[model samples]
Target: MNAIIHILQTQSNGILEALGQHISISLISLFIAAIIAIPLAIILMTHKRIAEIILQITSILQTIPSLALLGILIPFVGIGTIPSIIALVVYAVMPIFQNTYSGLTTIDPNLEEAAEAFGLSRTKKLIKFQLPLAMPMIISGIRIAMVMIIGTATLAALIGAGGLGTYILLGIETNNNALLLIGAILSAILTLIFSALINGISKLSLKKIGILFSVVVVLFGGFAGYRSFVKPTVNVTIAGKMGSEPQILINMYKELIEQDHPNMKVSLKPNFGGTSFLYKALESGSVDIYPEFTGTVLESLVKTNKNVSHNPEKTYQVAKDLLKKQANMEYLKPMQYQNGYDLAVKRSFAKKYNLKTISDLVRVEHRLHAGFDPDFYQQSDGYPGIKKAYGLDLASVKTMEPSIRYKAIANGKVNIVDGYTTDPEIQEYDLVALKDDKNHFPPYQGAPLMTEKFAMKHPEIKTTLNKLSGKITTADMQKMNYLVTVKHEKASKVAHDYLVSKKLLK
Candidate 1:
């Protein structure tokens, strides 16, 4: 049930957009393979030994893991959709190439002998008779290649190619079954439709329908390739707590300035990573824009901010001042979203203990088993700080990844879990995000920071992003977050829903 809802949500936010990315990789890769392989296969059939060696070599490329192969290609091809498509195409080669080779070579040698006996030229024999007869097998190979490419294309999602695999991976990271289901179902549906199309074409006379199918594949594939890899100037990467925020603002920018206003390309590159790493990526210029928190950037990155717990607007002002002088960045308008850190226990346990705030935990702190993410366990902003601020000393502290700790709490393995106040699971499982009465955690309001140059060039982007500011309350952002990170719902879908619910997307 959750899975179905999740799929519907992702589909809403350009699930077709992701489908476009994945299919583009598959179709283009397969098309290029077809062009290269078909001619080579024809030549190989004529000259036996070289083709055997080449086919064997191509088979080895198929065995490389798609992720590893793509990683190796990234340095040379750079990022975005190109390296991904190239890798998928390389993966798609063997079956199609071999099939082409097999289709041409396996023909009853007598047909060629007869053509030779009739004094037909070699080119005429291939063009008139051989190519037509090889259609069924060649098409069969393409069909297999297409199916293989679809599955391999999932790997491209890891490299930011953006596809159904994005949902699949997010599901895995967060243990969201709905996301896994959405990924599986979408991929299955696409493959089924494509298979039917290929089978339908094969049923048509070899003289014409095959040409039509091939042409469509080539045209769509080529266009997709040009769009994904060739275009996309001015990249902006955002991740961690602010992972989905850019999707909203980016689409808005795409619609308004890039579409409504023009001649400026804005690529909102989303990178999912820990806070520290995301900061590093931003500093190095790997990301042009990121949705970040006001207090976190101040406290964690620039310690001169006096650890002052200020309001959202004040924090943004502080961030703007600090970022300009230090990081040369600008914090745009902030959404009414705050992702403050919080602690949680199972709902039943909380209810039984009447635990409402951090102070309440002091009485039972020693009795509870606390699990915190590794980074949070010892960091000043993590478990250590929470314990220091609340004065609640626990009996046992287990340091694990955030996802693992959440799972532990969910399964009753731990009585306490480190949590984000805005995490979607807090609402989903009804786990209470404790009131930070003592003010232990810093504020992390959802906000975007962009390069000064990009900002000056496109004022409309800031305007588009500013629309989302204050549009989502902390609780509302929590629900959207759950719909994605926990529920395995698509980010685009979650964003679209929030937009529609608010009538932002009429």
Candidate 2:
């Protein structure tokens, strides 16, 4: 609890920024869903068949997994706020639409009849009678949708739409319970506050409700207009894949660039999904730069079947050339570290098994329970490569999130787990990384990846970032990761300290 309070105090500005983003996206999504669903419900009151079809579609949409939906939308709409809001609006629509329709359709028959007997026109009857009666139900629907939106909006951070989820993802990756608690608790509090606010609004008179709605519309509209037309443009937007290493690297990039060009505005989007998401963001111009690994470029991005040389420089050269020729992107000079894949086990377990190398794994393969992150489990250069190279296959394999797999191995839930060479958990858990005797995994030197056009337009930015070339070593990255993940230090501060220690920054 003290740790949580300390983090809250230290990170208050970031928390508030994330909270503002969360509120903006959630409210906008709810408002848009209301605009779409309520009017459609009212119009469909006279068209039951059409209404059923539309509602069924919404129900089907609601059943689709949120992450899957976000992935599908990325190709068409790109990432960040737009795609996040669209996905949220989809989820928010069904509840609002269903309740509004039900409220109107289920009005007391006698009261409706009395309104009709008073010679009220359809429009006048809806305004004076049906709408007022249905207001409570509409508010109830909005409340439900608002709560849902707030909860799911955390995921917006994954696609570079800044929100409270940034802390959540960072917390998970770094194993920081204080950060995780902050995100979860704040989200819960937002839910309660919005729910209570809706309840209060539900008790208001019709005139007051109308006035309140008008105010909301105006406010949302003004906010939208300001974002679209008035907001200052960010000169450089740098992003990173999930993990403390990427976050730290991007912070280094940001600091170096800003130090060189003090007038330039740079935005850092940390924990911005995985390699594919960041790559796509860069390709689509959503992000100007991100840290990427050479092996990932060869194995995942370019998908070349050509044999990659084991030499670090050769591998980076091949990746750099391929990216330039095929994708119109440039891969900058790589750092000295090789954050490649490795299989790690508890030191005691390794000692007991007499495991010293990848080949040694074959002896214990039949008894080993393996935990792996989804990427390592599925990628050819990952588990499959190990199987082919070392002729090793474990007795059981479970694919889990990257952060959870570390815990699994550390807690003895699994005998072994896939890990990166520089992962701080190797030290934290006292795990021994078995040598890759067969040299199955290629060198994975990290570098800044960006579009050639952006590089050309901002040549000075490239020059500024390349100052980090060959600067950070495996030990440096491991220590930085340890500071952020194990000690719960801020990634930005760690990056800044590293730069100052190296005399790269004043």
In model 1, residue pairs whose N, Cα or C atoms come closer than 3 Å (at least 3 residues apart or on different chains), thus clashing, are: 236-269, 335-470, 336-470
Report the error of model 2 at residue 39, Å.
0.5
Q: Pick the candidate with the highest lDDT.
A: 2
Model 1 per-residue lDDT tens digits across residues 402-430: 66677788888888988777666666666
Cα-lDDT of candidate 2: 0.90
Task: Provide the clashing-pair count of each candidate structure.
Answer: 3, 0
lDDT of 2 by residue, 1-506 (tens): 99899988888998998999999999989989999999999999878899899999999999999888887887778878999999999999999999999899999899988988999999999989788899888998999999999999999999989888988898899899888889989999999999999999888887898799899989988988987897776899999888899989999998998899989989988888767777878888888999999998998899587987899999999999999999999899999999999999999998998999989988888889999988888778999888887888789999987888999987889989999999989988899999988888999999999999999998998888888899898899999999999998889999999999999998
* Residue 277 displacement in candidate 1 (angstroms): 3.6
TM-score of each: 0.59, 0.95
Residue 406, candidate 2: C-alpha displacement in angstroms: 1.3
lDDT agreement with native, every candidate: 0.71, 0.90
- Check candidate 2 and list the clashing pairs: none
Q: Which regions of candidate 1 are displaced past 4 Å?
A: 1-159, 163-165, 172-178, 181-271, 351-354, 373-375, 391-404, 482-490, 497-506
